[model samples]
Target: MSTSTIFHRVAFIIGGGSNVGMHVAQKLKTEGYRVAFGSRNPDIATLEQKELFPVSVDASNPESIKSAFDLVRTNLGEPSIVVHNVGIHFQPPVRNDPFSVSSDTFAKSCNIQLALFVAVQETLASFRSDKSTTPKVFIGTGNGLPFLKNMPPFFLALASQKATMYTMMDYASRAYAPEGFRFHYATLVGPDGGLPNLDPSAEVGFYNSGPAHAKAFWNLISADVAKSWDYRFTYAGEPLMT
Candidate 1:
């Protein structure tokens, strides 16, 4: 390959202002890949890298997503890869039991997870061209536990929603592979991996422990990203092909 030949590499990160999304953007920027970081609040998109394009995006809205994609196309051209890091998990709606799960709570959990799914779907549909050497979609999974575990009431809702989203992701990957759209799912289980220390809960001893476990998991995530483009691994289990 000639040095002057542009690789046309770009990564669009949903919820890019904080958490794993920011870390992933940093990693990609370090490797010389163009990064478009999206946040519901545009002010949150912050990074020192000149190549990083921080934009406002509402993951749940199709029009908002299209606008983000359009902006990227105009400024950075079609992204070679897309990473969705938008999902919320808090102790709120404090579930007492499965039987107590409310319709409103369930909808909130599902909506949050489904938003990422819609973003990925729209992104895949917007690929300017199918003729590229590197074309992939990395959808970050917020629920990292195995499929069989009995999660807390709120988490049960979260996990089921993630599973449903992954099912769609699998079909989309299979459906689009012939046309050069590749979809990959990754479970981002951690409390800290280069997110700004804005939340005091993140500094607490108990909250920090989960992320400590997640830190080791990130090593696996690095290896997974490097070793294979498509595969699935439970946060607590061995690697398996998607």
Candidate 2:
């Protein structure tokens, strides 16, 4: 029997209704992984994609997360993978500085990222209940440079959370390695949403971040490994740091 067989494996994705989350879910469905996505509105997943189950989840509320995970567990089996793609982008574009962002908003941002840790714990607990032997994967989509490096002004919440999550993933990657769990943090260059100082035309050849990263993740999980390999990947989905 092959050590890797992804058919019908479950993936619980947070915020998988639209944007990059939608793209990732589409890719995973194509690869034959049963996907249950959590978003505010379950209605976003239409009749077209019958296999994708959408559950209502409020990213900021811990109770909502618990409920969502419980729903996923009851509906589909324990998930073989968990994708933390939830984030609250600052509205109105905060190009200025700290004065622009209120403490309440930052608190919400912190909660958004902190939810991943909670989800990861609950996910593992679910898997452990049945003593599942299948290797599990946790994937977190990140932004900007990790706070350890440089913090972009516009990405205040993102940088702060990304840095902490990076450290969390690093620790989990090591602690869970021997038990056959894999963790990955990927910082992807998203679609040309027409950001400042960037020409949309110049991105003609750039890899589509969502689908590309999804494929990269699937490939990683399919490959046989003694321990968790490559804790991070680049925007181009390259595992090597170059």
Q: Which candidate comes out best when scored by TM-score?
A: 2
TM-score of each: 0.68, 0.80
- Name the top lDDT candidate: 2
Model 1 off-target regions past 4 Å?
1-7, 48-50, 90-94, 98-105, 128-130, 188-242
How many clashes in each structure?
0, 0
Whole-model alpha-carbon lDDT for candidate 2: 0.66
Backbone clash tally for model 1?
Answer: 0
lDDT per residue as tens, model 2, 203-233: 4223235555676677666668732333445
> Which consecutive 10 residues in model 1 have the weakest lDDT in total?
188-197
- Estimate candidate 1's alpha-carbon lDDT, on a 0 to 1 scale: 0.57
- lDDT by candidate, in order shown: 0.57, 0.66
- Report the lDDT of model 2 for residue 158: 64
List, residue by residue over 50-118, the lDDT tens digit for candidate 1: 457777888756678778887776777677667765555433454556536677766777666566666
Displacement of the residue 170 alpha carbon in candidate 1, Å: 1.8
